[model samples]
Target: MSSSSSSSFIIRIFIICGTIFNLSHQIKTIDALQPMKSSSLFIVFGRPGSGKTTVANKAFESLSLDNNKNNKHQQCIELDLDVCISQEMKDNFGRGIYPSLKERNVFASGACDYVEKQLDEKLLKCQQQKQQQKDFNLSAIISFSFVNTDLRDIFRERFPKAEWILIDTTEEECTKRINEREGHFYKGDTPDKKKKEEEVDTTTNEEKDMSDWEFNPVTFPHIILDGNDPIEDNANNVVKEILGKNEEI
Candidate 1:
């Protein structure tokens, strides 16, 4: 072959290689730009008396409203594991009975174990559903009692893709809120009120005597927010972070 023809052939091969490389880069960029298709699973974790439930509810409401307003194809579900377990305990025991925080601690620990098992089952169900429908997504916001580092590590290992948000509230504030809400347990019954009044003495002491639960973040990447912050604002900030709207907020 002529030297000029050989040079031209080499040039043509180089152009083809460049085009393939450019196309691959563009594909990667496109994937990055695309909205994440995987359903986002979030765990709202904190100690008892923190605003985990409140924040979870706020996020649930916001997501529900957004879905209705925009007719978005995504679905968000909030699963309050504590509430579910508490109700189950209540039903098993009897009606018109309340568990003390200490009793609740025992209940929550066991309930969390059960909830985790249920989550595994649900994941399997979701996998089967996904095989039939490509657009089907299952998202969950869960609130749980996070006591030790080991539990945190387990959660991190189990749900590596999910986001964890910790509600950080001062002990004093949590106690105050708990005290205010305790009134609802008695309602307008006089005997119930008297019983509750007597219980307050012990409850106050219990609250004051409670130890601080420390959060060590050696295992999971978590975003911590002030529990005292307005629920609406906190929810919005969380949503923004989850959607990658604003960083370092």
Candidate 2:
């Protein structure tokens, strides 16, 4: 071929390659801009009296109201282990509180079942609502004293994508809160409210004292929030973290 003809052919090839590259880049940009379908499960946990439920509830309310940064298609649910425990007690024992180690163990197992059932239901619902091959987002905010690493592992295995949030507080502060709180079985005063009233101590009994339980990260990454901070601030920070504003969701 002549030099001019060869040059023209090379130019045509370059133009085709550039067009393909631009199209690929534009596709990626559009995908990045689009709202992704997500199933966000956040487990807010800490030792008992660390205000896990308080902040978890506040974050749930805030995230719900904001629709998690205006993702209108998202569905959010809050699950409290205490609430499940209460229900379990009421349904099986016709009581609101369980004090004995045997009773507590029974109720705790029942409560875990309840939580897992709710999670399974949510997962099924999300699976069924396959609209146009684009599933709407489902956000589950769960609160519990997930201090036992083994128990945490059970959930981590069940929901491989679940995010963990830990509310960090000193044992002293937790003991104070437990003492001040009323109407709960895990109150500061136990086994008759006198010798046990002054301090919250761990026991080697069958039913472990949750206040004495400490968190072990154990291969799982978690978002830690200061328990000393205002609950509202912690709540807002968690929402930001979950919404991918402060950190990767």
Candidate 3:
């Protein structure tokens, strides 16, 4: 072969070897930087229109700060069952009956169950996959209504390792806020209508004075924040609590 042709062949071989070596090195670097375990799960529970989404967003922001500051690439997932249920209801029942649909109220029960089950399955799969890879970091944040202790217990049983945060807001305040918020499932005169419906005597089947659902304390391991308080302050307090920092205004 000619000298110039031989030199060109050698250069081509060197380029191919260099490319393979660089690719292998990159794969090792990525594997080393990946998280080593599943991320933590956070469940934020509150009544309808009690600023659950607002608080969850704020909490995620604060957690992101911690993750960034620590140089940890942890994953955070916020799943709100209300939005899911509302969208499902709208799809099935249309907008009109959505106001008075007893089925919609029961839908929350079923949707929450479905979501919790799905989350459990996904978490298990993630853990198994990570076990193979020898590195996995995954977590979840679920926000839903905590009107019933049974429901909260079900969540605990489903995700035994999850961190629970319950936002306790008075029924009166929730109703008022719901009324003020437009385009919400519980917005407008629907709040007053719900109050009236709750007052109807089940046995007598007679409409009585207006009443709202009572705010019951959730029985779970949780950090409770008063929803009636300022949103920003309450959210900051939640961040502090989660990070084991001193609670400040």
Candidate 4:
């Protein structure tokens, strides 16, 4: 089935399931939330080696094609969460072996601060252009794993209106890719340990702690995409939603 049809079917199931329990009144319109006008913050979330950055970049390209046609002063940037950490943390993390949770936490905790600092600089630049009576278009794509749910509090309550794109991929696949990929923080000089999380790569016993590991779609209005799919292909799907091409009737 087409992606849109799949979404419709899921919603129908939700509606029917709700009605069966006499809780149909609780069902609300399930719409894809758009980013704030003129300035947008698109969060591209997934696990390590799950193509989050590739997806974010492709989505940014689409953003330009769809939103910057007439704007002369347009600015778009992609911020990888790794930038939040110091060089020492990144270099020492895993010591060229698997992933390091301790160092990752520092990066995760400082995500909000990093985004605000980036936006502040961008807005300042926008103000300068506006002073010259020119219009400015500002947008961003923040790509990160956010393996810990606590990292979400860094944004949800703050930038509640930002667009969220979840790249869903299997933990096994992510681990395999992380081991195969070269020159990534998750890789090692040789095969090392698996980066396990109570949330992202949960064991059978830790199922109850699932929310602590991965981002939950039901908690908020967001679009879900298969991370294993081709980057540009997945990106086009997201663009269709942003441009309302796949918006349900």
- TM-score of each candidate structure, all chains considered together: 0.53, 0.60, 0.57, 0.61
Give the poorly placed runs of model 2, Cα more than 4 Å off. Answer: 1-38, 86-113, 120-135, 189-219, 245-249
Give me the overall lDDT of model 2: 0.68
Every model: Cα RMSD to truth = 12.3, 11.9, 9.5, 20.0
Give one digit per residue, the lDDT tens place, for model 3 in 1-249. 999999999999999999999999999866654434344666777877788889888777876677658623244456777665656655432222232224434655676566666555655554445432323344566777655544556556656776777677877887688767766554424444456457745733221111223345765567778888887887787666555421210
Query: lDDT per residue, candidate 4, 11-116, as tens digits?
Result: 9999988787664333421121222234567788877778888887788787776555844455566788776757665665455322244444455557776787
Q: What is the lDDT of residue 112 in candidate 2?
A: 57
Clashing pairs in 3: 37-136, 37-137, 38-138, 39-138
Clashes of each: 0, 0, 4, 2
User: Candidate 3: misplaced stretches above 4 Å?
Assistant: 1-39, 65-70, 86-137, 188-214, 244-249
**Where's the lowest-lDDT run of ten residues in candidate 4?**
28-37
The model with the greatest lDDT is 2
The lDDT of model 3 is: 0.60
Order candidates by TM-score, high to low.
4, 2, 3, 1
Model 1: weakest 10-residue lDDT segment is 183-192
lDDT of each: 0.61, 0.68, 0.60, 0.63
Clashing pairs in 2: none
Q: Residue 216's C-alpha lDDT in candidate 2?
A: 55
Top candidate by TM-score: 4
